[model samples]
Target: MAYFTNFKMMMLFTLFTLTSNAVFATEVPETNKSNKPIPEATKFVTQHKGTFNGKNLNYKVVAGETYLLDKNEQPTASIFSFDYLVGDEKNNRPVTFIWNGGPGSSSNWLHMGGYGPKRVVVPSDAAHPGTAPYELQEAPETILDITDMVFVDPVGTGYSRALGETESKAFWGLNEDASSIADFIAQWLTKENRWNAPIFLLGESYGTTRAAAVSKVLMDKHLINVNGIIFVSQALDYQGSSPYVDDNIVSYITYIPTMAATAWYHQKVDTSGSFEAFIDASRQFAVDELLPALFKGNTLSTAERARIVEGLQRYTGLSKQYIERVDLRINAFRFAKELLREDGIAIGLLDGRYKIDERDDVSADPKTDAAKVISPAYKAALMHYMRTDLNIQWQRKYLNPSDPALSSNWRWRTAPDGVSWEPKYVNTAPDLSYALRSNPQLKVMVASGYYDMVTPFFDAEYTLNRHGINAEKIDYYYYEGGHMMYVHEPARVSLLTDTRNFIKEQLAQNSEK
Candidate 1:
């Protein structure tokens, strides 16, 4: 996944020329060949029965690879997917394609923690999940009863890999990634003869970015219309989420309400007021007061600046002096470190409920993320489940977070045509708007976590508010946890229920249409 400039490519070519002749002079050793023929695609199927939402459910799991082909129809890459089809009602049942973010991540997180039938049990209150023998259980809250689910792994993730002479980097950019995934979806629908089935997409974090772009691809390139899209911990607009940048005004405005919610959670802010009311106040202050003061820059009057600083202090639970020193713009990372400095603990950016005790307190950013405390348990659980329960026996390693090379080589290009490509903060809201316009029946459900600083709930609202999106077609749901909000049992059940309801409503509406 190494991204190389023209200069680097030329240098590598020259180095290869200098060394190739000498290296190839040695006699090559011959290897034995097996007569066994290689299969074009890998597939493993298993069946199971379970009770969900008071109904006995029977489902089949198809864990395998689907090859993505080039223009010549030669295999380019093997994209891995776990398809869970419920009952024999395949043609009419809704099908939801799900994946997590990271640009390089596999579908493991959402597969194991969110809506899959099998889930890893982690402490709900953001405590450190130590070592293994992690509890893995059947999640009755899964949406499998309402819709079939397919968890897909992109190229260079999970057991997916480049095939033939194709390079893995071919599917590493924004447009390339979306197009390949759309192709996989199209291939899957055709193979299963489920093209008439309602199609929904569920994506988390950067996967949300992919979902928006992929929706457009499906409509324009493949002539496939999406029924709905679900965004879990949405990050459709990077500029709003990236609070680290000093000059990102939208980031500052979008993050204030989340900081206020975090402060309320920690009991640092006054608890006498209702949480919802406090959040509304914070939102108002951000747009009406804070944003104006920030726009004024040095032109702001001393009294006005003082008023804004006081408002920030009250909302963020930081001292007025501290807010003034930072010029009223709170960097999320710094806030994580400074929030509970007196208690010798730093808050997590993903989940502010979790705290970490860094060795040194003076660091600008927290040493580690508190939300990652439960990651080991998740990894162990997924590996064990895949082998023991799902019975997926593969020699290749299952990459959890991602392959380093894939991420490093990932291209950030989002341009649709031959426009001058300049890498900037990725925003796919316009793509989503286009999808909505093209597909009138399409609806979107956005799930946000109160404690998720990485993609603040406010940012989700802001990103969806404009961009020509119909307000009636969108629904918002909020949880009491972090980015991977489903790790919390209550939130998990709530999310599943809300999503199921949304799907049912969408189907009913589509039927009437």
Candidate 2:
């Protein structure tokens, strides 16, 4: 939801305590008894034709339990691969592996609302649209109409997790993550034997790095081969990524426009010019004028500071007095509460556009990705699907990650580290570089949300550019979305439209090849 924009820190914090503290469902051992080479997939033909929020929902995928086994032939982790029959399961069109970004998030958001068979309803709160109605209707907008979509959860996020006493390390690290996914792909392909089906990767947040890493693991491990990869709010690396430093001043720099956009919706920004024009000018000033001045480190004259304050006030829709009061360093929380605190209103961090006039505007944390305004319907729907639709009922906590009660802070940390590289051990940076060279035809698309503070657009861009993906060969589109673009209905439609067009191009190009 809107909270996903600043999900990086929150997700990491949540991950550390999710499994035990979080109240989501938990995975159990698969119900099938197969002591063979590759355990047979729990094949079942079913349809989810439910209706909610006055809309119809539908799906016709082979919903079943997919498994990956060690040499001893015991169940490791369980996954549900939603196979949409392009023609027949035999025709072999193309298979796209889809996942959510959080190292802790499940694929439900992307699977349900993005390009899956169902979507959660947006609530009425203008500041934060939630599933107040608790409706999970069918989403015909699913890309399954074209490409076969397989939603995956990294090892711990969704139903795809190890059982009690199972080695959790089998699912950790860059290489481990890729190989686990690669193993799943290979087993699925062999179980299904659609060897000719071209593979594409779609990952959001950390999953983007997962996709990049996995493409190589697949090649080296002789696993799945990927054609194109899509990164949604990706973070390839985090060095010099965020401008939101020094408490809140620098964060205010980037978080301001988001604030401005929210303010504009409330008719608060300087009404002197059109919204887009106002935004463009403000962005330019921030990047060109303000940034240089701040980097000066006190070399700036008093007159210059006044000018910067003037521009910040004009663009941020705050009282010039308040702008000066903070010494030009208003953090996002203060900005959210103080910006409209007089009206007894508190804006939602997920989508700054939504506000609630409830209570005193006091925040527990300056940077909060609280799902308070998030729709619970998708979470509920995924739970239901796991039981009724897909029929996996181990149930402890559905989407809980490693842990959450600990003090977890997501800092730049370090490059994925020397401790672990999953699936098959390979250096991440060098491996990605080599694989791209091995198949220069592979193109990457890094999807970023401008308002996403979690995996800032700048960092995602920086990481990919570091990989040296040619600008010409890569497609980068900035959406006015938070982590999950679908949080705003308009953005959802726009993203789907863009995604469909991109897929159509791939299809066209595939035909020529």
Candidate 3:
């Protein structure tokens, strides 16, 4: 089995991907291809450049070798970084360190999909749940304009390879991952000579968790502090976000509000009486009635519990029987398939808005398969466009939305007895009080999609509230989309505008001080 290596070219191509919509402001259709080439221009190309979606751009279309060094400088694991420098290098612009989740996922999706130089073209009616000749188009709003981005794929993902099993496992644990990514950031900055530039960590899904841990590690361990951190659909404190146990009912409580919002957007639920009124009412019910009722446990009378379940089913689109059996607590998986089970369809896990009635008909897992169905089309279009139009190519495997190794156990530093003790809940919230006590310049912004089911916006909001970030400075934005919100043109343009504004503000604030 390959450990982790050769990711430069693969990581470079992550110029677009999945999640929330309505935040992006770019509405142009395949208007341009990226102008940046994959690094190591000579690595995999016979031609100097090519076209991507009829747009002129740069590309490094071949695999450029990267070596991983250990203590005393021994080759540890082979790894790489996809370098897409935004702005003029002569000026030494700020840089954003970007990544995706899945303890094992490569940063490709986030790189390409959300803030990258290239983005996928989604129809206006993105929530319709259909497929298309999806393609990657030039993205003018790539966070690149303000910050040069280095997208990374950890060991075992993309083209990263370790020396052997022993060295490989070194990168497989939680602490290991933190150390590895922190080290990578240090090394990348040194190699790129951008140590003087502001550093920001941007992550999605598990990457959100990764960013949180990395933020701490970078501070305490690496001593390299970042200017700002962006948690896209941030996911931290797994116990609060995931439904792993019975009391996991808390996860459902946070998710209900988000589900209602998405349903309202698609007109799947009754919003005739005023959508805000409806969601506000639901939120109130959740905070007041549902959460209290669930907390009471068996204390509630049978009729009371029944009434709560009825409300939950009505709002969540789940069956009353199923809701009752699970005590009104259901995870994303159940909702992904069961919500529309009568329609005989399972929704796409990556993008909840996508749906497939029959797995056999699609030849892929309802959750995973739908990604495959749409990804190839988008990817193929991306490859061709980036190579031909952008004229950039570093021949390494492009990180797809799917990677098997992502399922590996990377959360580590477990005790000898197999008891892992990471401060499950930081007794003190990770807010300005915690992170900014030493550095008040640190302000946090959370970009979320209201329709997102994976890391529901409400859950993220709840988590942030727990962190003690000042409600005033803590900025939150919601797109009318799910996980990878920029898939739609409207969202993409709006998100870009928001990103640009945020970066400008950060820079202005830094300078003013």
Candidate 4:
């Protein structure tokens, strides 16, 4: 699928597509004919037996597309999903719909690296996945015994695309994306005749954002309630997670603990005390001391400012002089570069433990994420699995990371174009709150990585601790890895264990009700 921003190219492509092949339209008028004669939804199914969580079972893998239709029953989009079904017990079995996050991302990351039956083997020690011929190992720890899984790829990703006169941008906005996925879920349930099954949502990164919004959409629009939601590296509130903006006061406070953890991992800070104790102290300092000092700004006393700077230095392992120069505010990306600057290395934002020697040592931030070294192996493994194991013979390219066109044309507004509205950080925490209130039985599990600078563990706490979200309904789990914490083997096992237990607990409660 492709989108042409240039008028001449769009005209040329339109002519070419009309005569030769069809083009996937993005932001095109309803009158556009480029996407005419949409092809049939694709499908490939296979069966296998696998052991998960000590239970051996036979399962069917349905690698297929589910087309979503409009109000008039016209095909609007084709969402590709990989469904792993253990048995035909639809009424009793729980179904967990999963996806990874980039506003434009496919489900490949979580599919090939985290919860799928097979995963690409990368170093668990935070080292780069060196080369190809990477091992694809069985991930028997995934919670297949307790629940079925569906990994979905939204429009313009994987083999999914806009159909007929529908513009790809129709599914690219925050609300649009969530609504489409909700529609897909409804369609999926009806198609599989599994509408009565208990449903769960598991999402990572922006997928977490989507999950919250999707939950609200499901309850309000579809009149369907999800049993639980699992947020892997929760990013519900962007204010806390975004460390790029200079004046984001919440971010300065939210990232302190993650920075402390990173400092401890790199041996940049004192390791004399217990790590957990130190993290707790860092959190305290952030809220109690640092938050006040940053808020006071020019009114802060010199002595108090000095004291806060000392605390920042102690927690972040940056020098007092450097902390003062930055006015006590440290951007996460800058910290990644400055932490090991003397060693001519830059750490990753996704996983602070991963480091790389960059050619440009003077840059303010890393040229690229050090943790992304495992991506190629993941993509390769998924492709191989699809072809060999699932018997998939599709020619369409799978947008693993995400499609460039989707990213470029993504809409972030909650309102339609031309609507008068003030812009704010993208947040779906309120939507989550609404869902929880509407569905009193609903619960959430937040899984965080100590070293994830992108969506700091502390940020998750800050975001979820308020906005009328009940504290007791949420369960928190911490890991020793980074953004994609499952990349670390121990974290992977622990995460699976936690997720499995969470699902089982939810089911137990469902039975009681």
Candidate 5:
């Protein structure tokens, strides 16, 4: 009986070995989904004449789909972009790739309300722009004459989407997003034969974070080094900007100047001098006094604490009682609500200049942001423009801000291995640092809105000043508007001029090199 059992065991072992070897040898043909032939990219080109920067220019607008391929060279997604080209295609005109941030936003904000040739007309003074018969007008302040612009909508935003068997969630993470955008950029350059053109990246809000990471990816993966980067409402570091969390000492320090500016704006603070001087004083107070007091925690002396409280009240316009109750660490959200609470209004986070009358005046945070009031106008303008002017006919629904599902599922992981990811504060300043170091000639222009409480201008200074960045290569531009500074006409023109000059200067510098 033992001999028979031994024979059966040997036979079974041999059978298992043969089956495993056969399975391994079959060479599963790289999954049919990944090996399938990809469809050709869809491109629609139209010509139009427009006057920008006092130049009567004839340009070609290319509204198209660029397919992002998987490792097997199979199409995985269709990324949409609106490319505006001026001058002869033969000449190497500098190209700027622009996108808005939300991690979920479409490029429509920048396209319809910003540097695009046509802009959606909203009230320029940060008023509550009522439901529109939204007027669209020629944006003569556009940078088209100096550089060709391509407004990109990342996968799952606008008309861009995951194709074939690929899931939309695959491109929703930090590292994955940067990699995909970098791939799209490389593909765009290759397809358009614009590899010789000086490439510039312009990103707003969270898009700034993407820009920093993608710059590194472009250099490391494709050996494509960008000439310059423009950060609109820069938010590379969250630790400095997030003011709601407890024990966030950096937030207390960074938000002081912005609060002072807001208070000055609302006349909550008595300031007779220049706004610059007032802001400078607030900065000085934050660094010299507020920062130290916050760091002292529970060990702070009565006199020192009292002095810091007085400084907070003087800068933020909050009463001494409120400051004392909050232990001198005033939350930005609460400040936004409480600053105007007596008047039954709440200030906007995006643009402190805008005010909202919340249903609950006693709420801890503002119910809504006034900057979002103009979103409807932007959405309407972009859809109408795309269909009428660009003549883009698509079955897919155009997502204005983004697909809700994508935003909900967005992975905030900053690192691939997930070991060093900060769940609370997403900081890509180090990525920008690496990129700056990798390409020393790479210039960066930071555009900030004085009234933008979301990504405070002071935070931008804090993030950029560190990381050993070359100060000479960095340029700072400020505007009197909110996060989308271009919404204001004067700011729009000024930012365009600054951008055009920056690009020109960088190109000239690169040529000399």
Candidate 6:
């Protein structure tokens, strides 16, 4: 769940190996038709009524599998999606396609915790959500009243999987994953007869990376134009988010504000001033002071290095010795463990507010994410809701994160095999820039959490602000919680309100055209 840790490093390493070897399997596997006939794509349709934003509306929930085909029109994979559409008005209303990240994730996190009509209740105060029987409450705050929703679980996650003959690894690469999602969107639009409706892409974490790439694919390949995109905890450029890597100067700079925010949350830093002001100062210090000192490396003078170390200490609340020990570049994971080390507690990387007392306080980084305290509740709620509420009776097991093979086989190479390419951070911000350039009317809303160490708010700023993206078309919204900011009540309400308004604003602009 954290950045470029072992799994991510393996992904990167695999890409490097593939590129260096300059070899790939050029043959697409034969269509999988075994001794037993492939089961028909399963689907469950249910009708329900609810009050959303004070408006009583009846909606249909279509939870099922959509087969993705090869160029020969043979089924290659099945993508499972949950479609929520207003009664009979599915074609006319705006539609937003949503997914969570993991590169191998199910859409369940955003589905159950953020935008779903029925959200699983967890402790908003960052406490453990305790055992099961988790409450499923009506999320009237969701923006469903204005837009039809499609929550997609990419292949290898949820009930989605590779069909006969096609291997799951076929959809486990950077380009492969985005292409499948784009294909699914086109297929969904065709099935629902909603090609004319305003389309939006909403993705969180690595899903944000998918959104940007998908937007470009939709425009360049499908001739489809998205009206807007919402990036929840954006990770379009991995360089800014990959803090675990050594000598990654961008990460050192990008993570300062987040560390400052975490320190402020734990009251490790001086908190007398406005939190916003402190964050602003941290951002400035990162760019103006720390970045240059880190860049100077061994050339930096002792006096200047000392001043920079003091600034880091002031913002990060880490001691001078620790700052010097790490050579003034703080690894975010260590910060999470060190911030509350004396108290025998480690703060959560996903949400700094959550703290756990680990058995081995000696570890440099937390063994597990403390913020994952709510995961069990979310998992239970989704499984229960699918069967009981959505009537999804399919026997297939739902993979929450993904299949083990997905991560192992995941490819990150950007170029075709044997193209003489070098490994680099996986970035899709340029794709988003291309999409914006192609569709002049398209705008983006970036929602970032102050406490999200996984994808820092400052990194979001660092990413979108560059990449030739138009600042005027990009709107930024900040939240109080971490990666899944909606877990915080106030943040959840504000996120939905901001989302609702952003969609409306985009639609309004469409009308004037």
List TM-scores for all candidates, in order. Answer: 0.92, 0.77, 0.78, 0.93, 0.91, 0.94
lDDT, candidate 5, 311-335, per-residue tens? 8888999999999998888887678
lDDT digits (tens) for residues 144-169 of candidate 1 = 88899999999878988876656789
- What TM value does model 6 have? 0.94
Q: What is the lDDT of candidate 1?
A: 0.82
| Backbone N/Cα/C clashes per model | 1, 33, 76, 0, 0, 2
For model 3, residues 1-513, the per-residue Cα lDDT tens digits are 011111211321121322211111111121112322122212222122223234443322222224444554444555545666533445668888778766666665665667766666655445442455565565755655466677777877766756432346668765577667877787666655777788778777667666766777777766877777776776765545554345576776787887677556545666668766877777877788898898888899998898898788767766688788877666654566666666677665445666666654332223332322344445565566445543444455654543444444443343443565553432213523365454566666677776666567777767777755666556787776666777666776777677667777878889998
Ranking by lDDT: 6, 4, 1, 5, 3, 2
Residue 85, candidate 6: alpha-carbon lDDT: 86
Clashes of 6: 2
Off by over 4 Å in 6: 1-36, 89-91
lDDT of 6 at 257: 96
Query: Can you write out model 6's per-residue Cα lDDT over 352-429, one digit (the tens) per residue?
Result: 899999999989888878887787887899999887887676668998757867776888898998799988888999
Q: Which stretches of candidate 2 lie over 4 Å from their true place?
A: 1-44, 47-59, 71-75, 124-133, 163-165, 223-225, 239-244, 247-257, 319-330, 357-371, 385-397, 400-438, 446-451, 456-467, 478-480
- What is the lDDT, from 0 to 100, of the residue 414 in candidate 2? 24
Q: Which 10 consecutive residues of model 6 have the lowest summed lDDT?
A: 13-22
Q: Ten-residue segment with the worst summed lDDT in candidate 3?
A: 1-10
Point to the candidate with the largest TM-score: 6
